[model samples]
Target: MSQRPRLHAPTKRLDIQGLRAVAVVLVVAEHVFAQPIGGFVGVDVFFVISGFLITSLLLAEHSRTGRISLTAFYWRRVRRLMPAAVVVIAATLAAVLLLVPQRAPQSLADAGWSLVFLANWRFADQQTDYFAADGPVSPFQHFWSLSVEEQFYLVVPVLLVTTLAIGRRSSPRVVALSTLSVGVVASAVLAPIQSTADPETAYFSTPVRAWELGVGSLLAFGTAIWGRLPAWFGTSLSWTGLVGILVSAVCITGQGAFPFPAAAAPVISAAMVLVGGVRGPTSGAAVLRAGPLVSIGNVSYSLYLWHFPLFIVIGAVDPSAVWWTVPLSIALAYVSYHLIERPCSVAPLAMWHRRERARFREALRPQRRSVQVSAIGLAAVTAVVLSLVATDRVRPIDIPTVPLAADATAAPTVGGEDRPALAALGKGIVDALSATSWPELDDGPGANLVGTQHPECGRLSPAPSAETCTFGSPTAERSLMLVGDSTAVHWIDAYLRLQDDGLLAGWRIVTRTAFGCPFIDASLGGQDATECASFRADTLDRITEVEPDVLVITNTFADTGVDGDGTAPGAAEWAAATQRYVVDVRESVGKVVLVSPPPAGQSVQNCYSVGGSPSACITETSSAWRSRLAALNAVAGDDATVVDSRPLFCTADTCPAFVERTIVKKDFVHLTSAYARKSAPALGELLRSRSVFEDTLVGH
Candidate 1:
């Protein structure tokens, strides 16, 4: 590694190299262990360092010449930052195309955004939800940090020049302080809100992160306050700051949405290190400046750039190869720094410094107009190249659409012959129910049957009771009640097929869309209101009162065994309530059929936005789904036959999101109406085989 020069002049040399080492190590540890650890605050540290150093250099130049050179400053920044960034991005794009699954189009889009420094916005727009266990993990996830830093570098110089123009008579320190104060206050105020709104973006966005950098800038421009401090005090503070940074890395995990309120740890620690290092040689400062630490600092930027792509590619090729691949990745990063990065950076710095010296001695300079024109030309070229690369990265594939074959069956005898009788029965039930009796189902629109007024229900006007929805033809032999939560309602379209084909044997299909309420009389207190509990109780009572021949109850088992917000249930209360409901349903219903809930999967909304067809988004082979079903089925004893849909919906290796070109779901978990209807033949076969419905009468 190249040795860093000791500062002889009173220039603002505040251990930027040491800070870079801190930033890169945090980022690496976060990725390696898959922890949050406020690793992203490393980017905040970088931003601050950039703002401080760049502003100081510009101010120094302006003081010497009485004029600021925007063109020269930008040129130097581009040469320093862009070469490595462009190389890394280009390499990442190639790796993405080669390694990522064809099913994951989002990876391609994310790569494209990274190239253009818009990854923060792209991630924000997509539901980069941290709560989901199996959400999309784009290889280019780290690009958001790079994008924010690059963006800050782009705009800060412009802002500084404008401020200097307006306040020509003001002291440089005063202007710097004013700028830092405004940035700090704005960032602190916006940080919490953005963190709440979308933490992934808040973590990555330059505007929301300006305060961390502003803090550093203020410190850089402010005269040394720590020179008067006792030597022991400075050393203690430095060691404490270093320890804080290390402790945070070891402790924090990446389970929830990140860098929100959690960002204070790394930001504060970084500021401490800056203060400690600036004060004079402390134990911690000496350690940071030591040979091993300085070597890591020299290669840290290249390490950060290379590690993610290496992990991604290795995982893509063989997810199980992490043990060997991780070490190999570190070795490769070290090699890349030595061979590619160190040489490139040194060559440019040497050439630029030599040119600068020659220009200084000659006392000759280009016209302002000529310099501006050259800068514009260079910018235009860079923009064009970046645009072309982005376009190529995100080009869409042409997938041919295949039409599904329809089942060959005519309309049922019930539609023509039993219509009058069914209509009369529906009227009779509606007349029996009071207007205030039925509760409005508060499940989402997709799950609410009464709200949607689905065509199969045959009620053009709203009905007041659960019985009203299920009132059969007077001549009907049996009544089939579709009881339970939204999953049961999803299968209603399938049951409607049986009804359409006269397989229902004049039975009525009743739907009770209680969001996640299991048929058991259990109360999810604080989660569901008293009114909702009552509504569920009343609905269950009505189902038992009507006494349907076959009761189909289904629910999504609580996978986490806790509420959506991750709070644990009161064990004694939950157990008692659950057992009571199970007993009650078993006593009241004649024959209960439990439909195993669909697997917890990625949201189809993100899949669609990323250009995946609906068919590509379904989960068929998730272990989470398998484990959930196993537990739920065990709870359902002999009284109810638990139907495992995994075999019907999924293959051994993969699940067909669309079987026979019919989409299995509208979203992640719920079935689409058309797909639900197509599933009727299989469900009908299951019902007949199990003797839940008589084969001779239903006519499979």
Candidate 2:
């Protein structure tokens, strides 16, 4: 049998400090600029470096002592990682309490999960409908990465120790390397597939992250392989790898188009740099060894810990001051490193090293004690988190649930299938446009948009195209035409209530799904996009053909411009375009009623996913939304009667999803049919106050 070569400890530390600097910078850039498709690959780089360094130390200990002490390993990890983590978590909790009022319950629940390192599952469950325009932001969003690393730490040691138990006779290096290889192959193959299947969940899940760590482990075990590479080859690989890292950071944008196949570029590139640049006195290695870079690398952990909270706090306090806030955040991060982080890290390491020189075994026992204490501290944290969660569940927000009306409009009977009554009214409008048939509309359930389709005229044949899908109603004597985007369709339920009550005596409802078009002379993709052109032409034709009394137009006035909060579009451009749309609509129709949208709310699905209950998702009143609505209302003024529903939907303390047993909205903003009916009284009062009903009744 061949004898195993004695394990050789690395005389030089891999540029871990340099690697950390790269990781921290990439993460900071991702949050601040949100560019570079591979910006997220920085986490993968961290994972690989962690696995490599940790494995090397563990293997070295096992080789020297013939056994590994799980307690000592965990103690060192806890001392190195937990103190900063605990401080950050505690500080964040305090900030949330003081700075964030009317917090989303779902966010609170996510924070609870994060405290316990279960953020991966919490985020996974909530990411199902990840494409929803409105979703609550978890305050502890960064903790998911920590959870992945912690989970790896917990599992990898067990696997390593088990392998040792089975192979005291075989080479521990071979066994460790073999296991790492298997993990790397499995993770790389599974990660890409998962990214395609469910990108949001895959992004946060730990299993998918294992491959990054496995890559580092493999490198650590194959140090001899790297050592044997030619100097020229290593230098070329190192420079190329650094270039790839920079390219990934500069090119990748965080708008759901990243952290997938594109992420492979940065992950592979970072690995190559780590492997190739860790040897010799090459230029790449020399750069990493620079004084400033090495110092930043040493304090990288502190910088990472402080930067996020500083940004979040600054943004919360002065959202419009991004220019100053960005620089201020960096300043605060540097101060935190110098004041808190450097002192703490140096003190602990000094104490640990001093004790290691004398009474080594006795000193190691204290390390085990520290590990036990950390374990107890973790348990206490878990209990506190569970208690908060329990308390939250037991004493949820006191949202009043209103009962549904006994005389609520009945569902429409369609081919023996019961459908929302409002759907029938919309069908009537479609039928009238198709056949050009007029029928007497009664003030019955079918007259309501919720009840039946085209009560005046029987069912018409289906139209072949968008141009042909039209309907006319005898009640449409004044020719009221509804037009715009999906927001227009949302208002149909409310319009049906007016129609059922004999308010829209002469009107025709028309709709087109123009994905993101405002009803004006707008260009999309550097040209007059189909939706914009169609909207302008169609409105002109409809006005000429129908000669409408009142034109009701509504579109989400927030999505037609640049985004401010890194999630949704800003309101400045949207407000301007909406004002223009109102002007054009007013010119075509004698009267126009511009409805300001409801208070922006959290996604119902996201809340349920995270909090496990509908009541747990509360709508947030965004200042941006309020500002845009105000701007729109200011522009419309009396020329367009602005119908604001803020009072009807929200109270001073809370916004109840269901008002009087009727679901006010289907998602974040659109009203449900039952809820729309409830709005009839308030809407009628608004119309009367604005002389809208008077104009219709007097026929002037």
**lDDT accuracy of residue 596 in candidate 1:** 66
Worst 10 residues of 1 by lDDT: 407-416
lDDT of 1 at 669: 68
> Which residue runs of candidate 1 sit more than 4 Å off their true CA positions?
1-68, 99-112, 130-137, 164-170, 198-204, 226-228, 242-258, 281-294, 322-325, 346-700
TM-score for all predictions?
0.61, 0.57
Each prediction's whole-model lDDT (CA): 0.55, 0.56
Clashes of each: 3, 31
Number of the top-ranking candidate, with lDDT as the measure: 2
Find the 10 residues in a row with the least total lDDT in model 2: 454-463
In the range 144-186, model 1's lDDT, one tens digit per residue, is: 7777766776766677777777677767556756875787788
Off by over 4 Å in 2: 1-14, 35-38, 104-108, 128-136, 254-258, 281-285, 323-700
lDDT by residue (tens digit), candidate 2, 70-103: 9988877665666676676677667655544334
User: In terms of TM-score, how similar is model 2 to the real structure?
Assistant: 0.57
